[model samples]
Target: MIAVVTVLLAFPLGYLLRSHLAANVAYAIAYLWAFTFQTLYLTLSMLGGDDSAFSKNEFPISYGLVAAGIFGIGFGLVALGHRVGSRRTTRQAVS
Candidate 1:
């Protein structure tokens, strides 16, 4: 799925971005951005006469929310990974 791939890709970038921002804030911002884009894209697709993605229904809205959540989780994983990585380095240096 595209959502999975996006998160997988974003995780590394999120880790790198942590150098500039705290991980929680960074992930929240990233999720909000991704959600905004997804909403816009879905709207445009509907306006362009694409009927496969939207309707007068709540399912699409929920799906979009889930997608954004997934991306946030992926971004958060980077922060988690950073913590694990730092611990390993310290242990290696000690032994």
Candidate 2:
């Protein structure tokens, strides 16, 4: 749930950063940022004594899914940034 938000946040950041950096780099930075946030989130949650976020039997699976999802989201955002950036370039070339 919270992890999903981080992934979603990466999309816009990747899009916005595309103009200043390569798509891959932008996505990587966004993903790393999100990952850092997630780490902090988990650490805080544990320290704060909230164990509800972790399921007894499903913890490992859930964590893996979230990590993979974040990676995929980063790649997707880079593709999206490239698509959008290419459109402008294509239009300018035609003009």
Candidate 3:
């Protein structure tokens, strides 16, 4: 699924960004940005007269939220990876 791919792709990017930036808040904001873009893309894609994705009663906004949640999982993994990475670097430096 697209969501799975997105999450898998986001995880490494989030980890790299966090490692380079040295700012946790920046990493959060960077990953959170995908939500706005995803929502906009889905809504606009729907409004452009494409009805292939959903039924008459369904909406794109909901799907975007779900996608964003998937990305959040990836970013959480990034946080974990960053923590582990930093610890390793610190240990090496101490020795």
Candidate 4:
């Protein structure tokens, strides 16, 4: 649910910012920003000792996998939006 919201938010921003930066750069920015936030939240949850969901998992590896998956899907959408925005601008220029 959270991932969906993040992607939804990123896509439009990426589309709107298409002219401001390269697609890859925007994707990298989005990826790093999201990954950092996730890492920080996990670290704080563990340090705060508030019964972290990450700690309760029998398979600790799942956390990394889930984060990767979320980033993969989320950032892919960012790139897709960038591409769409680029195409839209190109079409407008052509006409």
Q: Largest lDDT belongs to which candidate?
A: 4
Q: Report the C-alpha lDDT of model 3 over 2-85, residue by residue, as the tens digit.
A: 454445554465445535444345545555575566556655777787666554566557666766677667567667767766
**Model 1 backbone overlap count:** 0
Q: Estimate each model's TM-score.
A: 0.60, 0.63, 0.57, 0.62
Which residue pairs does candidate 3 place in steric collision? none
The regions of model 4 sitting more than 4 angstroms off are: 1-5, 17-21, 56-59
| Candidate structures ordered by TM-score, highest first | 2, 4, 1, 3
Off by over 4 Å in 3: 1-24, 60-65
C-alpha RMSD of each candidate structure in angstroms: 3.7, 3.7, 4.2, 3.6
lDDT of 3 at 73: 71
**Candidate 1: segments with Cα more than 4 A from true spot:** 1-10, 13-21, 57-59
Candidate 4 per-residue lDDT, tens place, 17-89, comes to 8553554466566667766776787778876875566664455687778867876676677777778888899
lDDT of 2 by residue, 1-95 (tens): 43565456545654555453565665576667766787678668866777766643444567768787768766776577667766777898999
**What global local distance difference test value does model 3 have?**
0.60
Question: Where is model 1 poorest over a 10-residue stretch in terms of lDDT?
Answer: 12-21
Model 4's number of clashes is 0
